[model samples]
Target chain A: MAFEDKLSMILTIGILTSSALMLIGIAAILIQGGAAGHSIKSLIAANTTVNTRTLTLQDAFSGLSGITAIYLGIMVLASLPVLTVAALLTRYIGRKDNLFIAISATVLFDMLVAIFLIPYLLH
Target chain B: MLLLLLVAAGVLAGFIGAITGLGGGVVVVPFLALYLGVPIAYATGTSLISTIATSTGSARSYIKERIANMHIGVSLEIGTTLGAITGSLIAAEVYALHLQYIIYILFGLVLFGSSYFSIRKLKMKNFVPGKADWSTKLFRLNGSFIDEATKKKINYHGRRWLLGLAIMFIAGMLSGLLGIGSGVLKVLAMDSAMTLPIKVTTTTSDFMIGVTAATSSGIYWERGFLQPLLIAPVVLGVLVGARLGSKYLVKLNSRVVRYLFIVVLIVLGSQMLLRGLGVF
Candidate 1:
């Protein structure tokens, strides 16, 4: 199969899995009355500020044990693109396409800085 | 009830975005921030997540249909990713300074600008193939895809690659800054600068947005903006709605989509501007 076909398959599966996880999270929240004791009312409240500052990664991961579905879903959604880029870079390397490899590397570096370096610098 | 409302909103956004070939972040941002009273920062972050879902949702068919140009998309990412990093830095500064109103004003301006271009684009006919420039040869910016509607294989090459990259850089910055896919600007860069077909422009823009969003979303996450609860319903709804929307896209007349886009842009643009100016 062509590269595009592989990519499409990966994207389709990634999206389906993430969406399913998100839906399950919603169901759990609704039925359980909220994630980890926070009521659904407060979680979705119009005036709420439930951001990363308030909800740590540790908290989110802990909630992954059937307490909250959304956090894991989001983790999957966010990481899929990074993984796709990595795959593209690997393909370019196999073909020895320096130009594309460089471009892909640049994109990965940018992502890394945005995800890790910048946040660390800000502190 | 709130989850249901979010899902409903996401579905509408995804439907309109996919059908119009505009992408959903534009609609999601304004709807969440303006209509639903979410903070602008949180709204943008949430919309960024939705963009990834919509892109992934429609990507399968786009790839199968072969309307998208991966070479062009990957090459353009060089500019976009760098721009996204810059844009996110700016966003961090703006939020820290509590000058998010400036971003609102910029978003409004961009929306109005894109609407103008969308109308202008409507008057234009199909692409008249142009000569490939030096950059095109260097970058290998050429490909052919079958036009599903015409049932003919359309062969084409791209020119003005550097120009396209420059425009894509700005588009990337806007994507990161606003937490949108910024497909309008990406399409504009390709459609106007690269002289690609509108179909190619839209599909290729769709192809590129996911990586761009991911790059910035990482920053949004680090900045403590990725609110999981808010994102769940929006992501799921948009993925499903966009899938349904893509099925109907080929059947709709271009003129109808253009008109709908103009109307939406006008209303959302003005609302964002008014809210930014403290008039709302």
Candidate 2:
């Protein structure tokens, strides 16, 4: 079978895999009986009041890790198609470096998804 | 309000990561935990995904340039891919055994090793690369690249054999578990053990990174660690940043890049330690 055909198959696999995981996590929350909803506690480790929390003087980051993980997972399967295309581009088109550029393009696209796609999803 | 901030952070981290050859995961993992109120475990998952994505950006370019040795890369990839499956399984075992301290120690060592090489290799850039030995003769680990500054082509040789594969296996295992590019390990495997030159080692390391990412990506996906909510911004940011950085490589200084690379690793490594300790 062609790489493209396999790629689409893998993508389906990725979607099914990720969605199942999310559902499982969400189900864990449901089973926890409102004890573990996707609330601030589910997302963040600490509980700081909005007004009185001490702000650090330096450029300390207000990290976005939970959301970041969600997006990172999303990007992988998303990039698989790009991975397939990159492979094809190198194989039939470039004929020079072959799988290398394909992998690079696939990775680059994964990063881009993180930068551009996450905000809308949160809302 | 927080959503806007995350978008901005994603963009900033991606730009810095692309220019430096640092994994976008290295940038995003901490940023997500500290700024966006993400948990350490989730951040790690996101970071791993971004690392896979960002590495591929360079993988494409390197391959396009024929800078990557595909045969060696793919051959080594088999080891990495299988190692990844085993390592991912081991991640669960390690976590269950509560031997997370071991992982922290390992991360620290890797950081120190990368720093030493980055520091030490600065002055040795001009040496003549030695000839291809038994490995290059047997496995034929050889390549050529156009020197950007000189506009002249530089050829490299990887003349060792048995040792390089061993290094590749070790590198792959570490890479799968840690979510790193393992570029340093790949370089060590190629340059020192296999007798590859510095240039070829870097390019080959670059080439090898994507396979490492792919290896773990499969498991991360299998375990349901990947989520769309996190993957989008980091991947987009990395793609743009990598492109910008690649375009600017000719004008950049290698030493500065190397230094920046070490600094980021140190910061990220510490963050991982802190998170693992449950202090942050």
Best model per DockQ = 1
Worst 10 residues of 1 chain A by lDDT: A60-69
Candidate 1's fnat? 0.79
lDDT of 1 by residue, B1-280 (tens): 6778788878977777676656688888888899888889988988888988777676567767787777788889888888888888799889999998998999899999999998887887666667888978888877886665676777888899989999989998999899988888888888888888766777777778888888887678878767777788888789878888878766655566668878888888898988999887
Fnat across every predicted model, in order: 0.79, 0.02
Query: Scoring each candidate complex against the real one, what DockQ results?
Result: 0.72, 0.06
Real A-B contacts recovered, model 2: 0.02
Tell me the tens digit of each residue's lDDT in model 1 across A29-106. Answer: 777777765777777775676677677667767745333467778878877778777878999999999988998888
Give candidate 1 misplaced runs (Cα > 4 Å).
A63-68, B252-256
Give TM-scores of the second chain, every candidate. 0.94, 0.83
Lowest summed lDDT across 10 adjacent residues in model 1 chain B is found at B249-258
DockQ class, candidate 2: incorrect
lDDT of 2 by residue, B130-208 (tens): 6667656555567677766567787776655666777777776776666665666776676667655554555556556
Q: What's each prediction's clash count?
A: 0, 50
